[model samples]
Target: MNGYGSRGSTPGQGRGFRPRGGVGRRPYPQDAQEAQAARPRKLSCPPELRDAFVEARDFLAGLIAALGLPARLGFGGVDPARDGRQITIEVRSLADAPDRPDERGPDGRQEPGDLAILIGKHGATLDALSALTNAFMHRNNSRDLFFSVDVEGYRARRVATLRSIAQRCATRVLREGIALELEPMPPSERRIIHLSLAANADLQTESIGVGSQRRIVIMPRDSAPPVEPLEDFE
Candidate 1:
């Protein structure tokens, strides 16, 4: 059996669940999927990159097992992301036991015994792992190495969701001719927002704030809100 990273979108809570970010976000469409901005695309592990890809795959598998998490790794192929290529491997849960609360051993440090822990509150740990792995590879390899670690297919699904949300927000921004702010997101998520809106000329997107407080604001090409049509009164 396979479960995606973090129990983000629950079965019944899909309609209500929004990846809550910082407070004070103005109302927008709850269903980002309806925006139709994000479309799924496939990537292949180029033969030239196979050796490098396998190196990361084996490293993460051993690390997970050493942590007492027996997982099956799936190579998600490499894709262009940021400066380097993004290589993702899906870590599937071999055991379906419910996530256990963080516990400290004799040393007094919390141990990772569940896949959920790898995902963190809002994928903090997951993002960290991606950074860590890339750093590890960079030190070990002469050529540039960029790797993104994901539990199951969370990264794939997340990419789609982010694209959708971006499109939804961009749609409203264009229609209302008003600038809108999205909840705070990590760099990877924010990247998705920016890439998703790159094709739209009527809208402009930028990141504001610093560190964890950083978020995206989508604005129409013009600052002033567009005039309301007479159709509203009729």
Candidate 2:
């Protein structure tokens, strides 16, 4: 969610987060499951898809090792949608991950190596890794698909946390009868908040702000006024 779409004179912090789809109730999905579900499935499995899956997993394993993580993977699996594809690989442990920065080199000191650090501020690095995997696997793609990487159970845990945050904020908003703002979060997390509260008929959720500073505002449905829609990318 980008650009603050102010709702009346409600008081809050600097503008908050935005998510996929344009402003105005865009539900482009915020999590891996939703993303995979969004894809259209093919009726029959294509032969090349099996090869693609094997190729993708093997490639991912190599990529992980090349990135300096070895034996850290618990396992990875594929979720084929009739004809589409979704492969998820996991980095199970950071026990072997360095707690300190690497030796100095011409490029300057390297930061400590950990899957968590590689996950970036909001799974940004993970997204990049996914894109890279797909790029390498594109030739094997007899069908379009989505590829993603997760550290431990981070994504799943985060989804649960976001839902908790949403519920907590919603309760406060309803109790106080005023709009409330939440801490800044990425589009994916924001999407979870939106999805978690989507069923409440008495409440409304709005995302505001631009770039990394964006977030969500919880307010009453009857009191919600029209605000320009915002768009966000995972």
Candidate 3:
């Protein structure tokens, strides 16, 4: 997920738009009632693991309180199985967020004021929050954790849009015989592009850039020889 660099070009004019996991499979989780029936009172986790999630939830709650933002959150218990070597945390803002665009400053480029502050330039704030949550979990649990914090449904909608853009770019790259350089995107979004194009034999892809300026470059697959055996890998 961290393959791509941070933010890229504005997604608005990319010509096309609108669009997780290992083993290519993730099992369905049991309902709370059914799970309780199957494994009653098995919710106990190591204190460290338990606190990792708890502290994360609490930290966000405290932040909301400190900012005087009205939000109601229900802390569903954490699943130890799902809480692995890396703790994964998810936060959703109960209140609907307003759409505020960037404003132009004296400089030519528009300065992202509130939106940038909220998302943190290049999503750095969100990333830092994630890291802090992971650190707290790892320090107590002695295991690393991966956390994702989403304001409203931003992350979900972003993923959907990225998938569509990746597909459209892939198609264009195949047809034009010219490489397409996408606007910088988060590492997770880049992963979506990679996965979307993984099966296409007609095209080859690679990401280029540094930090938040990184973008994915897609081009036609030359009639090249096999790099490695498919069976040797997944």
Best by TM-score: 1
Clash count of each predicted structure:
0, 9, 8
* Ten contiguous residues with the weakest lDDT in model 1: 7-16
For residues 41-128, write the lDDT of model 3, one tens digit per residue. Answer: 1123346656455566676666656655544332223435564544333333322112222222222222322222334433556667
Backbone clash pairs in model 3 (N, Cα, C under 3 Å; residues 3+ apart or in different chains), count: 8
Candidate 2 has an lDDT of: 0.54
Q: Model 2 reaches what TM-score against the true structure?
A: 0.59
lDDT digits (tens) for residues 1-234 of candidate 2:
111111110001112234334365323223444223222122232455545554665676677677666434423445644333675655543332234224322222221335455466556777777788788877655446767776544555456546655776677678768676665677878888898999999899888889988988788888954332223212
Give candidate 3's TM-score: 0.56
Candidate 2 Cα RMSD after full superposition onto the native fold (Å) = 14.5
Candidate 1, residue 57: CA error in Å? 2.7
Q: List the residue pairs that clash in candidate 2.
A: 1-18, 1-19, 3-209, 16-214, 16-215, 17-214, 17-215, 23-229, 23-230
- TM-score for all models, in order of appearance: 0.62, 0.59, 0.56
Per-residue lDDT for 127-173 in model 1, tens only? Answer: 78777677778885764557777663455545665676677667767
CA RMSD, predictions in order: 10.6, 14.5, 14.5
Measured by C-alpha RMSD in angstroms, how accurate is candidate 1?
10.6
Show where candidate 2 strays beyond 4 Å.
Answer: 1-50, 74-84, 94-113, 224-234
Q: What is candidate 3's local distance difference test score?
A: 0.46
Comparing 2 with 3 on TM-score, the higher-scoring candidate is: 2
